[model samples]
Target: MKRIFALFILLSAVFLTACGEDEGNAGSSGEKDTINFGATAGPYSDMVTQAIAPLLEEKGYEVTNKEFTDYVQPNKALANGDLDANLFQHKIYLDSFAEENNLELSEVIIVPTAPMGIYSNKYEDIDSVEKGSTMGVPNDPTNLARALIVLEDEGLVKINEDVDPLRASLADIEDNPKSLDFVEVEAGQLPRLVDSEDLAAVPGNYALAAKMDLLDALALEDMPDDYRNRVVVNTEDIDAPYVKDIKEVIESDEFEEIIDEEFQGFGKPKWMEEE
Candidate 1:
């Protein structure tokens, strides 16, 4: 009986020791309070780690960022739980992605990315461009409409006032003062066409991807607040405390300082612009 009792004690001690080691290992991994974040490869990812993550740490949250090279994967990773949240795209892209994929993602907050600039390598400025000059624009819906908005704002073209800005197409153009010939190209291709087209409207993300300077562009649109980039999360997490905390941090002055210091015209905040 004594020997049996001793053996039972030994087994119990071993089991407890094993369990303790597992707990210790988990703590050592340093992911207990960490949030997995996703962003695209340029300034967005840099801002996440350099700016946002530090703020999250101050609020007792740890952030680990995953950077994606292209547009498709960040959304895919977030939808399937590979990422806790993603901060790379605007509302238009997120909404269209959700509808098309039947994935339920929700926007946490609108983050200010840089405006889509109407760039011209051929002409020195909008005024110098002659009538009937070729224009390069994005063919993708959201960016295409975004480009049109800039063009119209610059008085190079006009869109039907009734059309939704997100859905506006060439067919919606009410007038073309320059009789401007628009050549539809992929969003990524517009920057490459700077020397060829009279004006090419390029989103800041694509501009970054193409290694172009946003501040050097000739004309920028009066960017609407809705056109701002968004930080998004799974629909189930829309009301989560951490998500709310994330939004608060984004809106804070600390984050704004970081944005002004790091991102230049790309991913610029409205508050930063005011300053």
Candidate 2:
């Protein structure tokens, strides 16, 4: 009986030692070392996964990019601590989204802007647009305002000076010499409307998806010094380390190269150098 008890104690000690080592190894590997990111599904998000994430991994951050379809959920997830960062919206859109949803998110970095363009199968140039011609614009407030701004810039229409970009509408059009009929449609459907309407203002991503070339467009949004293209993070995490690393990766040359190549010069890197 003494010998059996001694043998049992020895086996127990060996088993405990092995279990302790295994637990230590798991603790080291299972610790939270990955930066969880979110982005809308598109070339932009794919670029983040392909170019940006690899660069971050070299710097010791494990990047897990979560893809989202709609705009609001990504910000909400970031604000609620479900994500470390998101790279799918500009400052103007982000500000408007936060205001309408009552969320407190902040801009951490400026990404590329998919320049909004006016496309027309009927006309080759903005000047060719006839009076009383129908024009399609996005119905969403954010994109509607953006489309209006593009029109105003092209001298097609004049927006009211007192109206904010967030709230501008057809009513704000103080001058419309062309008397163009404005047809408001869903932003995603704007490109399709080009076939029916005389002209339509479509966002760059949608235009690309619809296989429309930028050169084919009547006009594109100007990339001026005041252009507001950006990525956003939760206000509480604006200064976080992982978020900073994300900004650096996005601003890196690798990301710039991807933008220039994949977008065929349509998407320029505005964050790094002045255009």
Candidate 3:
């Protein structure tokens, strides 16, 4: 009986030690050496692999990149301590997702993000858009607001003065000078509709995924800094040692050189533009 009891205690100690090691690797546990990052598959993931990871590796950290295929999982992973940081969503999205899900995520820095634009096969330029023409926009709330604001910027439509621009919808349009007919389409499908619709408002990420050039748009969005993608971390780890390292690398001159060389056509944040 004494021997069996001693073995059970030994096994419990081993199990607890293993659990602690796993927690340390999760990043929020204050681990400073091995850091994990999450991003959507494509440009943002490429950004981590080609630009950020090398710099962090040079600083003696082991960096791992996890590519998520959907918008939902990255934040879910980040919130549950699966990722040290993530770089796929903008400030507005970060704020909304955190509030809705009761997650404590925060941004470390905004990165150059692809801007949504008005793409049309029927019209060569914004001026050429005829009256009563139909246009495609994202069905999602945030991006729909963004597309409407872009249309307003181009003098195509006007949103109601009292509505929050981030939550604007087709019903919020106070005036449509062109008498434009609007169609709400799933964001991923908007790119394909460019050949069919009079004009389609394609978000920058989807446009790139569809192999459309940012320069091909009739008018690109004059995006506010809130719409730009950012590096996100758990609120608790905002001031972690590894988080500081990641921020310094992004703000480095070497980082700008990489973005300029590899990420042309992405919209710059105000801080980046000011520099």
Best-matching candidate per lDDT: 3
* Tens digit of per-residue lDDT, candidate 2, span 1-275: 99999999999999987786566223344433577878888766876787778888987877788999987789889888888778787766687789998988888776666778999989989888899999999998867877888899889999989998557988899999899899999998999999999999998878877878877778887654234456677787677667778788777778778767766535454546763
Off by over 4 Å in 2: 1-32, 96-104, 223-229, 265-271
The TM-score measured for candidate 3 stands at: 0.85
The predicted structure with the larger lDDT, 2 or 3, is 3
What's the candidate order when arranged by decreasing lDDT? 3, 1, 2
lDDT of 1 by residue, 1-275 (tens): 99999999999999987786566223444333567899988878887898889999997776899989877899899988888899888776788889998999999877768778988877878889898899899998878888888888788888999998778999999999899998998888888888787778888877877888888888876777667878899999888777888898988899888877887775455654665
Candidate 3, superposed: residue stretches over 4 Å from native: 1-31
Q: Model 3 over residues 1-275: C-alpha lDDT tens digits?
A: 99999999999999998787677554445467888999999889999999999999998899999999989999999989889899999887789889999999989999989999999989999999999998999999989999999999999999999999888999999999999888888999999889888999999999999999998999998899989999999999999889999999999999989998988778888898888
User: The CA-based lDDT of model 1 is what?
Assistant: 0.83
After superposing all C-alphas onto the true structure, candidate 3 shows an RMSD in angstroms of 4.6
Query: Which model is ahead, 1 or 2, in terms of TM-score?
Result: 1
Q: Report clashes for each candidate as comma-separated counts.
A: 2, 0, 0
lDDT of every predicted structure (CA atoms): 0.83, 0.79, 0.92
TM-score quality measure for candidate 2 = 0.78
lDDT, model 3, position 96: 81
